[model samples]
Target chain A: MSNGQETSQETFAALEALKEHYSLPSLTFSVPRQVQGLVLPVVIAVVWEALAQTGILPANWLPAPSVVVATLLELLRGGELLGHIGVTLARVVSGFLIGALAATLLGGVTGSSPLVRRVLDPTLQALRSIPSMAWVPLFLLWLGIHESSKIALIAVGVFFPVYLNLLSGILTVDRKLLEVGQVFRLDRVQQVRRVILPAALPSYLVGLRSGLGLGWMFVVAAEIMGASRGLGFLMIDGQMTGRASVIIASIVLFALFGKLTDLVLERAAKGLLGQRGIEF
Target chain B: MGLAGAHRAALDIRGLCKDFAVHGGRVTALQDINLTVRQGDFISIIGSSGCGKSTLLRIIAGLETDYQGDAEFEGERINGPGLERGVVFQEHRLFPWLTVRENVAFGLGGGRENSRGESVREHIDLVGLTGFEQAYPHQLSGGMAQRAAIARALVNRPQVLLLDEPFGALDALTKIQMQEEVLRIWRAEGATMVLVTHDIDEAVFLGDRVVIMSNRPGTIKRIIPVDLPRPRDRGSYEFTHLRSAIYAEFFRQEDKPFAYAI
Candidate 1:
C-alpha cells in the first residue's frame, strides 16, 4: 500500500510462471540490453524536436520537446504531479489487489471442479464479453461519483481477465505432470502447492497483466468522469484550459510510469522464475 | 543362521484387468495379467505400441486405480500411490520450474517414507550429473534429463523402481550409455526394477527376465530369462539371441507384419 513494489513483484511472479511454461528467454541483466530498449524513444524525441525547432508544426499543437521537459520538471518540483501520480497509482494497486485475489481464488475453485466450472463459467464468460467500459455508468450510479465508485469500477474492469486466465491456467495443466505428482504420493494439499500452483502460474500471470492493463484504463475513465486529484483529471483539466503542454506532460508522465511499473514486473518475473532454473 | 525362509515377491499381480470406457463400449487395456517380481531383480516388460505396457506400469505404481483383480506390493494390496514405489516416465518429467537438484529433492519431500533419508547431492552425483545441478530440464540433453529423473526416483529409496520406457526417447549412442548407467545404479541400489520398453535389446541388456507382452487387450505372452553376464555386449551372439527372443512375441501371429520391418 505504501509503495508499488510488492504488487508489481506479484504480477512479475505470475509472468515468471508463464515464461517458464512457454520456455521463453528472460532478459539478461546487462547495460546494453537496458540501453537497447530506449533507442526508439530517443529517436522519436529527436524527430519531434527537429520538427518543433524548424517550426514546421505549430508550437501549441506540437510543443518543443525542450518545452515539454521544462514543464515536466516544473510540475515535479511543485509536488503537484507527484500528488496526482501517487493518487492514481494507489487506485490501480488497490483495485488490482482486490480483482487479482478474488479472481485467483474463484479461478482455482472452478478450475479444479468440472461442476463449478460448468455452473459459474458461462455467466462469467457472458459478463466478460461486455467490455469493462460499459460498467462505468452503472458503477458510478451504484457507488456514486466518489473514490469507492472509481476504485470499484477499476476492480470490476480488472477481474475478468485474471479470472479467465487463471481458470484456463489451472484447467490446462498437463495431466502427465499431475500423474507425476501421484507417483510421488503427494497428499492433496501438497499436490495443489507443488504441482497445480506451479503449473497454473503462467495463465494466472497472463490474467494479472491483462487485468492490470485494464485497471489502468478504467482508472483513467473513472478519474476523467469524476475525480479531481488524479492524472486523468489533470489531463481533462489540460484539455479544458487548452494547455497542450500540460496535457503532453501528463501523457509523458503516464507513459513513463506505465513503462517503469512494467519494467519492475519484468525484473521481478526474471528473479522468481530464474531461481527455478527458468531463465525468464 | 539356522533355517532360511523363502523370499517374498517384490510385486505380485493376478488376473489384473484394466478397461477404459472409450467412444461407446469399454476397451480392455490390460487383460488377465499375472506376474510376480522377485526382490532385487530387474524385470523388463517389452511389448508393441498400444499393448498397455505403460498402463500396466502405471497400475503397479498406483497411478492408475480402476483396474480389477489383485495387484500387490510386497504382499500388501496396492490401493494408491506410495513412496515405497518410485516411477520414472519416458519423458524426464522433471518440473521445468525446478532445477536438476530441486527436482531430485522433490521425491524426498512427501510420502510415508519421508524419513528425509539420503542427501540430494549424493543422488545427483550417483547419476553422474554433479555439475549440472542448477540446469533446467529444457537446458538438459535427453540423456542428462533422464538421469536427473532417475536421481529423483532413487532419492526416495523406494523398494521398487518402476520405469516406463525410460530410454525410449534417446538417440542410439545416448541410449546405450544410459542403459549402462541404469545397470550401474540398479546394482548399486539393489532395489527391484520393472522397466517397460519396446526396445528388445534394451530388455535383454538390462533385465534378469524379459517379460514379453501381446498387443491390445494386453496379456503376458512369455517371459524369457536373459542368462547373460554383467555388461552384456550388444554385438555378442547370446545377447542378440536373447533380444530376438523377446522380439519374437510380436511375430507370433503369422498374418502380422514382421515386427522389425516397421
Candidate 2:
C-alpha cells in the first residue's frame, strides 16, 4: 500500500485499540456510577450502628440497627409484612390511576377551549391552593374510615400536579408546528391528536413522575385514619405501644419502597422518551 | 414562456393591500400588488429586507386571508390554507421528533384530500436524499434538511408550490446546489412555482420571469423576462445581461442603503 494509505489503516487500528482499552475498566465494574451512589448511605448506616452499640443515645428511644433488622425479619417470617405491603400498594395504585385519568381528560379540555377554561379554571385554581392534607378530615366524614376514604385522600393528592402540567404542556406546543398542521389543512381534532399530543408528551411525563411521588406521600396520611393493616397502621401501632423499633422499621420500608417505585418509573420514562431529550 | 401563457392566469392578484397591527398603529406591508402567474410558470419575487416579499408568498399560499382586493387561485376566491397550494418556509420547519421519511410523508397520509400521484420515495429521490430516509431533522446537514423540507412540500403534488426564502440560510455552495435541485424538481413535476428571495442572481437563475418589488409597502416595480436557453450559462454575455438587468432595478437609486427609494 502507499505510505498515506498504510498510515490511515494503522490509525484505524489504533482507534479500535483505544476504544477497547477505554471500555474494559467500566465493563469489569458493571455500573460503577450506580455503585458510587451507595457510598454515602453505607457510611450513614455504619455510623448509626456504631452509635447505637456504644449507647451514646438512650437504647429505649433509638433502637440499635440489629434490633430493627431482627424485628423486620420476624415480621417477614409470619407473612404479616407481606399483608401490610399489599394493602398499602393497593391503595396507592388505585388512587393514582383514578387521579391521573381524570386530570388528563379535564386538563386537555380546558387547555384547548377558552370557554371551558373560563368556566372551570377559576374554581380549579381556587381548589389547587388549599393544602392537600386539609382534606383528610372532610374525606373521612364523606368517604368514611374504609378503603374508600384512604383511596380518596391519595387521589386528591395526585390530581393537581398532572392537571396543571398537562394544561401548560398542551398550550406551550410550538406555534410553528401548528402552522405546518394548518398548511396541510388538518382539522382541529387531527391537530390535537397528532401534533399537539406528541409535542406535549415530555411535559406530561414530568407530571406523571411527580404525581407518582406525591401519591406515595399521601398514602401514609390517608391510612392514619381507622386503618388497621397497612404499613401506616404498623407505624401508628408501634408509636402507641412505645416499640420505637417497629415504627422505625416501617419508616425504613417506606423510604426503600418509595425509592424503588420511583426508580422503576424513571427507567420506564427514559425508555419511552429518551430520544426526545426528556429526563425524569 | 412568453405573454402567450400570461393570458391563462394560474394565480392573479389585483389591487392587493395588506396591513398589520403593530404597536397600536397600522403598518402597511404591501400596497397595490398586482401580478399574474401563468400555468407551468416559474416566477420569482425579489426585494430587500422588510419589503414584504414573504407576505406576498404567504397570501398566495392561503396562509394570509385579510388582505384588501382579490387574490384568486385558478379563478377561485382564496379563503384559507388548503392542500391545493404547498408551502416550503424559510426555515426547514421539519418536526424534530419525525424521521426524514416520516416528515416527507406527513401530509400524504391524510390532509384536506389524499392526492394520488408520485409516491414519497420518488420525491425523496428527486431531492437527492434516498439513503438518509430514517435520519432525524437534527442529524441531517443544513442542505440535507432543506432538501427534506422540499420533498415534504412536493409529496403533496400540489397545483402550486410556494417557497419563502427557502435557501436563504444555506452556505453559498449549498444554496447554488439547492437551486439546481429545485430546477430539476420543477422540470420533473411541472407544477407552477413561486419563489420569493432577496438575492438577485437566485431570482434570475431560477425564474422564467423575475418580478422586482419596491421597498416597504412593497409593489411590483418591474418585470424582466429571461429569453435564454435551457441551463443558461452563468458566465455568458446574455446571462450577465439578464442578471444585471434585474440588479439595475434595485441599484437604479444609488447613494441609499436600502435597495429601493421609499
Candidate 3:
C-alpha cells in the first residue's frame, strides 16, 4: 500500500507538470507590423527570381522578378500602367457600389415581406441563371464598348449573389428576436434598422466579399472584349503585339489588387464581428 | 394606492382561442382559456408539453395575430403589442450584434421624446449588469444571457411581463439562482408577470398563484393560491405539499386509461 501511494504521488506530480506546461501558452510571433504589408509581394519576388535563375523554362516566356519590376516602373514612367489601373479601379468601385446598394435595398424589401418575395423570386431566379458574360454582347449593343458597358457588366455580375444572400440572411433571423422588438413597441422602421439590419450584417459582408470578386472578374472580361484602357486592355494590347511581359504584369497587378481588397474587407469584418455575441 | 392597484387586475384574458391549420389537420392549440392577472402578481402556468401555455403568453403579448381572444390591459382591449406588455422567450433571443446595453436600448425606440443614453444605462445597472453593458450576448453564460433578456424586456417598464420558460435552458444550480433573481426583479419592478414552466417546484416557489393546465385544447385545470411567504423555503412543508399536489394532478391526467374502458 505504501509503494502504491508513492507511485500514485509521483504520477500525480508528473500529470501536474504536464498540465502546467500545456497551460503555459507561448507568445506567438506576429509578422513585423511595418514589414507585414510587404511580405506577400516579397515572397512572390523571391520565388519569381528563384524560378527565373533555375532556367527550367525559356527566358522570353518567363521573365525574372527584377525584369517585371523594371517593366512595371517603365510602364509607370510612360504613363500607361497608372492610367489603366486608375480606369479599372474607378469602374469596378462605382459599379460594385451601385449593384450592392440596389441589391441590399431590394433584398430587405423581399426578405421581410413574403408578398414581395413571391413577386420578385421567379424573375430574379431566371436572371441569376444567365451568366454575366452572356450579357456583354447585349450590353455592348445597348451601351456600346464604353465605360457604361463595363459598369453594366460588373453590376450584373454582382447583383444576384448579393441580393440572394442578403435576402436569405434577413429571412432567417430568429423569430424570437423579432418578438422582442415587438414587445418593446419598436416601430416598423426601428425594427428594420435596429434588428433586421444588424442581424443580416455578417451575411451581407460575405455577399459583399463575393460580389466584389465577381465584379472585378466581370470588369476584366468586359475590358478584354474591347476597351482602350484598364488591366484587361493592357493584356489584349500585349497579346496583339506578342509582348508576354505586359500580359504577365497585368495579371500580377490584378492578383495584387484583389488580394489587397480582400485583406481590407477581412480586417473590417474581424473588427465588426469579433465581439462575443455576434455570429459570423 | 398600492393595495387598490393590486386589487385592480392588470390583465383580463377571456375566451382566448387559438388554432392552427397544420398539414395534418386543424390543431386546436388553446380553447376557451380564461385568466386574470392582478397588478404585481406572479402567476405560473404548469402543464405538459403542447398544453398551449406558450401560445397563451404569445397571445397576451400580441405576438400571435391569428388568435381569437379578448385580452384587455387596464380595461382597454389589446389589439396588438404595446409598450405595456413585455415577453421573455425560452431562448434568450438577445440580438447577436448588439452589446447588453445596446440590446436593452433596442426596445427603447429612436424617437426624440423617448429617454435616451443615460436612462438606458440605468436600466442595465438595475438588471445587475453594470459592468457587462458592453459584453455581447454570446459572451454571457446561459443564466447571464437570460438575465440580459429579462433586462431587455424590463427596460421599457412594461406593466405586464410574460416569461415563457425563461430559465428552462439553464443547469439546475443556475436555474435556482435565476429563479431567485427573477423573483427579486419582479418584486422590485412591481410588474404583473405570467411565467410558464414545467417544474412543479418552480411553479410553487415563485408563483403567488399556480394555474395547473390540462393538455391538448388546454384549459385551466385548477388555480392553486400559494399562501406561503416571500422567499419561501424550498424545503418547507408547504412547498413540498404544493409541489406534490401539482405532480399528482399532472400524473392523474397522464394515467387515465380512457381507451381501455368498456
| TM-score, chain B, each candidate | 0.92, 0.91, 0.93
lDDT of 2: 0.86
**Model 2: per-residue Cα lDDT over B1-262, one tens digit each:** 5677645888999999999999999999999988989888899999998889999998888888999989999999787987779899988888777778888888876442232235788888889998988787767778898899998898878978999999988889989999998998989988899999999888888999999898877788888887777697788898888888877777773456563566
Worst 10 residues of 1 chain A by lDDT: A1-10
TM-score of each: 0.85, 0.85, 0.85
The sequence of per-residue lDDT tens digits that candidate 1 reaches over residues A1-280 is: 1124456998999998998799746685444866898988888999999999999979988898899889889989998988999999999889988988888888888887789899999998898888777888888788888788888888888898899888888878898888888888877778888888888886677677778888888888888888889999898988898878888988888777777766766677676566554444
Error of 3 at B247 (Å): 1.9
DockQ of each: 0.37, 0.32, 0.41
lDDT by residue for model 2 (A166-260), tens: 88899999998888888998888888887888888778878877887899999998776569989999999888999999999999998988888
Best by lDDT: 2
Query: Candidate 3, residues B152-195: lDDT per residue as tens digits?
Result: 88877888898999888788998998889888888788888899
Steric clash pairs (candidate 2): none
Model 1 CA lDDT for position A143? 85
Which candidate ranks first by DockQ, i.e. highest?
A: 3
Off by over 4 Å in 2: A1-31, A57-68, A275-280, B1-7, B110-118, B228-262
Docking class of 2: acceptable
Candidate 1, residue B21: Cα displacement in angstroms equals 2.1
- lDDT of each residue in B1-262, candidate 1, tens digit only: 1122125688999999999999999999999999999888899998888999999998999888888999999889888899899888998888888878788888777442332345688888889998898787877778899999999998878989999999888879999999999999988887889999999888888999988888777989888888889888989999877766655667764356775558
Provide the lDDT at B39 for model 3.
Answer: 88
- Whole-model lDDT values for every prediction: 0.84, 0.86, 0.84
